[model samples]
Target chain A: MKTNFRTAVLTVLIGAGTVCSAVAQDATTILQKMDEVMYSQKDMTGKNKIILIDKAGKQEIREATIQQKGTDKRMFRFTAPASQAGIAFLSLPGDVMYMYLPAFGRERRIASSAKNQNFAGTDFSYEDMESVPFSQKYTPKLIKTETDAFVLELTPKVRSDFSKVTVSIHKEHFYPILMEYYDRGGNKVKEAKYTFKKIGNYWNPAEIEMTDLKKGHTTKMQMTDVKYDTGLSDDAFTVRALVQ
Target chain B: MKAKITVLLFSIFVAISGKISAQEENNIKLSGELLTDQRLLLRDNNDWAWNENRLTLKLDKQISSESKFYSEIWLRNIGLPNAVHSSSLYNKGIIDPYNLEIREAYLQINGFLNKKIDLTLGRQQIVWGTADKLNPTDNLNPYDLEDILDFGRKRGSDAINLQYYFNYDFSVQGVFIPFFQPANMPVGIFADLLNPSIAMPQGMVLNNFSDTLMMPKYNLGESSTVGLRFKGFAKGVDFSLSYVWGYDGLPYSSKNMLTPVNMNGETNIQSELSFMRNHIIGVDLATSIGGAGVWAEAAAFIPDQDMVMTTDLSALYPGSPEPVTQDSVLLKKNKPYIKFVIGGDYFFADGSYLNLQYLHGFVHERGSEGLNDYFFLRYEKTFFNEKLKITPIGGGFIVTDWGDINENYAIAYLPEISYKATPNAEITLSAAIFDGKGDHLFASLKDYNMLMLKMKYSF
Candidate 1:
């Protein structure tokens, strides 16, 4: 009777392993799909309102213009909040970044070693703004599967501020709506949730909220006038563009 | 002072209400700012001597796909108080301490060569250097140095600027100014140390031997200034090479004639300051390394003529009789010098930002050697979700030699605190504390230790 029970447990264990492997493979496919749909071959332009909520529940609103190309280059120019207007940020490949301030009337090339620093006093860090292809930066493993979404934990291949990131991908559209960043101890320190809207042929995030658990503050970004497939020239991404 | 503030407040209210009513009916976009600035003296009876009511209107409209118009008109009324003793003699409304002024106006067109070239014309400010806060190579706009401490206000020059982009990494920019406007020099008690005059006995007068008298004359049509800049990214750095043919922003002279007069038991002295034209070749570079932003700006100026500070008693004014003795005179040369600044900035995750920079005036000649160097730092941190920011700043030149620079070094501390009362309004409180040897730059301003507060609003 003991031998029969052991054989039956072995068969069930093998079946479960196969199912888990299948789900893990599906997770990889889903990540690839998200990357494919999330990026554009041409350029894109949009505007966003950055609402910063402090610990006291007070809100500070800032408006900005966002432009992105492929997966490597992006620029954000502050347009509202008179004090912050004309402040700009640009991130290019090679982990390079630049910032322009109206007060300085010039551009500053941000150093790579500073990548972990906060970006423009926001909850997001400089690395968070780097739009490198996720497939290039993180290795994912399917941790769980639900009826509507799949949970994947990603470990960065390079040195990163976060040891691991947990992401939730929607099953139907393969879009990432939730990302929780974890420290070495696996404690959740920060998380971001995105709301996606289908525009023409693309599914894009219309709103994003990132909350810092330790700081007790949250930053919510709402996109407006999002346009894709713009025929933006490469010159617009080069260093010469900062002067304007 | 209370009445003046009330008048300004009433005016701003009227202006804002008018704009709101007209904004919805007009297609042209309009925005403006109103500033109530006051600088209180910590050492004197003047509660806020540097008080002013400032307004700026920014307008933009798209003419077509290829062109647009942009302009910002700034008007400020600087109220008057009993002028500082050292500066009262020169104030004679030369800079118009209380008046209206237009700051900037420009039209932009992008119609040349498939939109690869663009032009900006009209009165504009062309800031040309990459250095943070302190740009040694920027010489295009004349400075409004009415308040030498207020370095942010740049008097725009009327110019036509053209830019041609050669691919993404390179561009050539040029500007032309038709007339020369010398930098505004504020002569006050603080100026005594830097430009103190030799004591004049009764019946003594000083004059310029040159044909021009008090002010240097420039032909409106012939005294045009030109500038060229080629800026782009190379290797891993953003660099620029610039050339400017212009006059010195500060008025300095080669010679002076002193005259003495005794009329009706009164003594008076008169003096004229001369200026020289100069050409500058500047190179500026900006790059990043090791988590800091690094920048450097250097300019080499070649004066058209050697500066000679001449005091000749033999040559008197046309109306006065020449001296019989032909007293001896003093002659000195203010040779050319090079100015450069190197700086770096680092920003931390917790909103702590620090920038350090050094500036120097280097010369080859021993007696005419300009100055040694020193560095400055501005450290800032934000708190309470950027609602509040505190900054501590200190910087000034380290002086050497008595001909121009005096005292070993000057140190200053300017701590500022600011609060964002609302999305459109802000209040700032700050103080300037200076210390140094008796002759250093900071020590000369020992009398002006100040606490300043300002409130600004934007629409």
Candidate 2:
């Protein structure tokens, strides 16, 4: 009777380990698929707008011509709201960034120390707009499987503003549906939600909303006229390009 | 010839506009700004206040895929004729203080030399420095000192700038300015002291008010003004090395000596202000570390000759005018000096930013302590979703070897609060306070303590 009991216990333990391994693999696969789908293009250009809503429901809008090259470079030139016109921002790899303000008539290099700070008075931080691939920056573990979404708890593999992030991914298209950012104390501080739509052979987030729980403010970035694989020049994503 | 030149330029503009209108992708943008300032002098309850209104109109035209044109004109000082001298229209039939000043009109072309070179021609502002306000490498344009109450404003330069890009991260640029523009200095009244426009005895109440200031014009060439810049980004750091063979923008002269003349029933002082060739070599670096932005800039100036100014103070202190109580003295010369600044800035979570800097100016020539050190601090806070920004900026200067009779230190503080009422409108309120004694920087401008309000509307 003792020998039979030991055999049963071992079989159950082995089966549980195998199940845990398979679950982890599934979480990674989901994250990889999401990254692959959004990062499939070499370059893209889009007309973007950021709408900032304050606590009192006052709204301010900024419009820009946003372009991206390769997977690591991004540039934006503000065109609306005369006060912010002719302002350009360029982001390169290694957290290198630059800003050209027409009022100053020169390009200023931006350091990486303020990555977690607000970007252009928006609720989104610079890190929130950073293009570091999710699969490259975080390690995911399957927390639960929903009826239509996969919940993955991510621990940053690199230095990040958030201690932990819980993300929800669409089951069919593998696009990120939601992300809740937690502080070091494990308190939810911010949440980002995305609504994806298929556009010209690719899935894109047509609407993105970022909410700051502490500040009680929300910022929405809506994408329009987005074209993928447009063959943007590498020079266009550089600091020198800000002059134009 | 002038009319012909104007017609030729007009033809070029019309041709470009025609081409752009024909293209489907061309865009023409029109925008402008009007800034109105109302200031009150704390010391002067009656006269000598800061009041000015400015209007700027800008045009941006995309001529083609590789060409663009931009232009701006400034209409300054709307309410009074005191500031009408800057307007050429005043010389014409327009008799109001509503003066017109062309700020920038530049055409930029790309895709030259197989897409490696670019050019910008006409009047434009070019800023070159890594530091904030305490920049040592920004010597491109002459300053607008006509309004002493307002500082840090500069006029654009007419030039042709050529740039050659290398690998998109580095570039070599050369600027050729065909002419020279000197800093503007206006005559002002001194209630209880000597007027700065003329080198007369302090506190001397002369029966006749007469002074002659002769200003010389300098032509541009290898001996006058030229700029060369090389900038590159490497290893997460951006750096630039530049040189300018230029003249002092603030019309200084080797013949600044004052001569109290008594000739042909005239008793006044004559001072000559001229420009000479000078060379400046500058280098700057900027990088990020941990979460703070660090930058430094340094420039070394070499002048063709030394400047000397004579001060005769004994005649004004209850002394005889002929056998002066003390002999006239010539101030020392600062032949060549170096100016440098290092600064860093950081942002806090509450959307507050802070910057601190240290600047060392080698001003004193023959002293153990030749350096004048200044510490600059600036703090800004964005409130109510960035609609309101409050900034407090100040500095402390420590002159190591101060003047024999002047104060050894000085301090200045300015706090400004600006509110963005709308996307195209802003209001700013600020105050300037200065304190020192006897030849210190703040002491010199102690009478300029003021409260200012400015409204800016943009479209």
Candidate 3:
């Protein structure tokens, strides 16, 4: 009787393990699908309007032109707020980044370790501006499922400022609606909310708001004149083009 | 002639602006800034050092898919004019301390001959090197020291720059400047004190002193400058090798004369100053290691001739029974001397930055023996969502003679705070403090401690 009981318990435990494994696989698949949905375009160009709101409700606006090729190359050139005009940032594969200041008339290489620093006084960090896919940078596990969304906890595959990130993804479209970022000490530090609009065949992020929990600051980025698959050449993503 | 040139340039800009406004394509873009900078001396008797108001305008237009034009102009009122004679401003209309400057006006053509060639014509700033403000390889333009506080500023040069690209990661650039322009020295009391002093014998006192600056002739082979650079990126590092054949922007004392002593036991001295010719070979590299950005730049200057000052002292000793004697001092040997800078910068998680550099020579320092070692450091932190920044520590330490550091060392401190009043405006308050016991560069500036306030708005 004891042997039979032990066998039955073992079978039940094995069955639970299999279910957990399947759930994990499902979470990864969902994350990949979400990445594909966001980065499926061959290239994209748009004008970005960024508004910074302080704790006292003071707002400052800045504008830039953003261009991206594939999922690993992106460029941002400031066009508004005359003080910051002609400042540019280029991000390439393998965590490489370069910054150009018009006053200096030269491009400077930004270190990978500085990824956690704020980008141009905005709430978004350099890591947040990278054109990398979420599925490639993070490993996701299903935490729970709501009525219309799936909650997943993502742990970084490499060294990162955040210990983990929790994202709420749409059930039908696989697009992320909200994300909460936690610091290395496991404290929630930032929150980002996204609003996506279907542009032709692709789901484009029309607007995004990132809030710094510690600083009591929020940055709102609104995209305008968004164009996808415009056939931007690889030359546009190089350092030579960055200075221009 | 000067007024004619100014009017002509102004008319050209006005015509261009009018044409651009009439065009419907909207290809031309305009931007500008207005700034007011005031400074006060922090000495026994506090006095105003500078009260400057400036307006700058920039215009950019796309002429074609592969060509573009750009121009920048500055209109400034820097206190009262220095002219003491009414005749100096006779024909110059509305000369109320106003000056017009054409900072840059250039046309760029890409894919000139092939897909790899590009050319830029007219006046432009050709900045070189990977370091920040202190670049040893940046010599194409003359130094603009009109405002001593604005260090490392340079005047634009009229040149033709051609670049040929071997690939996306590599390129070669050549620049030819048709004329030489001398650096603008500081005005007012600083200029007076910076003049070289002559030492005389006990019995002979200085009665009169005169000096003349001899500029090179306008011939192409004598006064023109040329430069070449090869730039490339490899293994996550950007590097460049450059060469410049030019004349030094600063003049040196080349000849001197001591007049015969009069009955009052006084003598007169005359000096001639001229620019020195040099060939500079430079190399610069920029890369990142871990979390820090690192850069290094070095330039080897090879002078065409030995720098010697010949002083004819025969007249001073009229009763001497010997042949006419002359004194010769070798200021610099005809050999290669190097200037280099190595630096690194890092950003911390708390929104603070630290930059450090070790410089082997200052801008005015020349020759191996005259060069001094310096270490520059800057630390800044931002608050209030980066709207306000405080640079608590920003300065340089000069070691004039490493062997006698205790007596030959100097220190300068620049503490500053700036606030972004708006997205397009900023207000800054800063102070410059200097102290030293030796005869280093900072020692001369010790008495010029100052407090500065600057307000700038851009549109």
Whichever of 1 and 2 has more TM-score, that candidate is 2
For candidate 1, report its TM-score: 0.82
Give the top-scoring candidate (TM-score).
3
Residue-level lDDT tens digits of model 2 in B113-149: 3478777888988788798755677777776656554
DockQ of 2: 0.75
Model 3: share of true interface contacts reproduced: 0.65
DockQ ranking, high to low: 2, 3, 1
Model 3 chain B is weakest, by summed lDDT over 10 consecutive residues, at B15-24
lDDT tens digits, residue span B140-188, model 3:
9998878765768998899999999898889999999999999888764
Pairs of colliding residues, candidate 2:
A113-B291
Instruction: Give the candidate number with the greatest DockQ.
Output: 2
For every model in order, the fraction of real contacts preserved is: 0.47, 0.74, 0.65
Would you estimate the TM-scores of all the predictions?
A: 0.82, 0.85, 0.93
Q: How far is candidate 2 from the true structure (C-alpha RMSD, Å)?
A: 6.0
Better of 1 and 3 by DockQ: 3
Q: How many clashes does each candidate structure show, in the order listed? A: 14, 1, 0
Tens digits of per-residue lDDT for model 1 on A203-239? 8889889999988999998999998887876767865
